[model samples]
Target: MFYAILAYHVEEAVAALTPEEDAALMTDLLQINERLYRERTLGPAARLGATQDACTLRGPGAGMVIDGPFAETKEQLLGLYVVDCATRDAAIAIARDLRRVNPTAVYEIRPISLYLPGVPFPVTPS
Candidate 1:
């Protein structure tokens, strides 16, 4: 099974870190990513740009493009990792290790349901 791990952290906390501390943290994350790649379980992973750079589009097709942060929450989504694992337990283990390095962050692990090319997804109206 494939799992997507969404990482969230308080932007202020991150901004408060010393330059050395921030560099060290980034190094640790790089090591973790390298290990994941070596284990062959890693798929896509990336740290997003600052929330200020984000834009939200709502209502209908093409929608109304709104330029600004999407939410008023203190914590913002930092990044995500997609991993192929044998079970949910295995995925949780990976998340635990990641949390050890990034102690202040919260992670949400969810299984991925991939659709084949040209396959249609069934949508039910609320």
Candidate 2:
């Protein structure tokens, strides 16, 4: 089974991190990512851009294009990780590992119902 680990964090809190602090956090995260990659369980993982640069399209037809994100929650969806796991417990364990490094952030784990691996794109690791 494949799981989607949605990472959420308060935008203000994340934006408040100093460059050094943010780099340190990314280093910790990359350590775990490296492990996953070695284990061949890692899939598509991405750290999304800030919501201030996001836009939304709603309603019928072409819909109304609006600036900003779709939600007004305290914590915005900051990033995501897709991993192959045998069970939900295993997925939760991965989330726990991530939480250990990012204690203030929230990780929502959900099984992927369907996945289509389209054309792959070269991604430079952050």
Candidate 3:
């Protein structure tokens, strides 16, 4: 089964990280990602851009485009990871590994009901 791990974190808290601090965190996270890749369980993963750069289209039909996520929450969705695991516990274990490296971030794991493999594209590291 495939699970989607949604990462959430306070925008301000994440933004406060120094370049070195951020790089160290990413390095640790990537190490785990590399391991998952070798295991052939890792799928598409992405770190979303800032909410300020996001737009929301709500209402019926075409809908109106609104600026920002506009969600009333302290922590915003930061990134996500998709992994193929044998069981829910296995998926949770993967999230635990991510939490070990990023203690401040929150991960919500959900089983994927339907998955569509879209066009493949090269992902440039940030």
Candidate 4:
């Protein structure tokens, strides 16, 4: 099964950290990412730009394009990963590992479902 892991963190909280603390956090992140890549558990992953750089489109007809993100939340979504795991428990384990490095970070794990006209969905993990 494929799971999407959403990672969230408060921008201000991160900005308040000292340069050394930030470097340590980044090093921890790189180590975790490297391990995941080596294990082939990490699929597509990327850090998103700040919410201020995001824009939203809404309204009738063609829809109005507006500045800012779609949601207003204390913690912004900082990054995500598409991990292929055997079960939900396995996915949770990955999240737990991330928590060890970034205790303040929040994660949301959700299964990925795909549909095709003729392709059959497999019962096993990919």
Consecutive 10-residue window with the lowest summed lDDT within model 2: 117-126
Q: lDDT per residue, candidate 2, 5-103, as tens digits?
A: 999999899999999999999999999999999999889899999999999889999899999997767899999999999999999999999999999
Candidate 4 shows a clash count of 1
Cα RMSD (angstroms) for every candidate in the order listed: 8.1, 2.3, 1.9, 7.9
For TM-score, candidate 2 versus 4, the one ahead is 2
- Every candidate's lDDT: 0.87, 0.94, 0.93, 0.85
lDDT of 1 by residue, 17-105 (tens): 99999999999998988999999988888787777778888999879989877656668987899998999999999999999999889
At residue 115, candidate 2 shows an lDDT of 80
Q: How many angstroms is residue 93 displaced in model 4 relative to the true structure, after the best TM-score fit?
A: 0.5
Tell me how many residue pairs clash in candidate 1. Answer: 0
User: What lDDT score goes with residue 123 in model 2?
Assistant: 70
The candidates, ranked best first by lDDT, are 2, 3, 1, 4
Runs in model 3 deviating more than 4 A are 122-126
Best by TM-score: 3
Off by over 4 Å in 4: 59-61, 115-126
Model 2 accuracy (lDDT, Cα): 0.94
Q: Show how many residue pairs clash in every candidate, following the order shown.
A: 0, 0, 0, 1
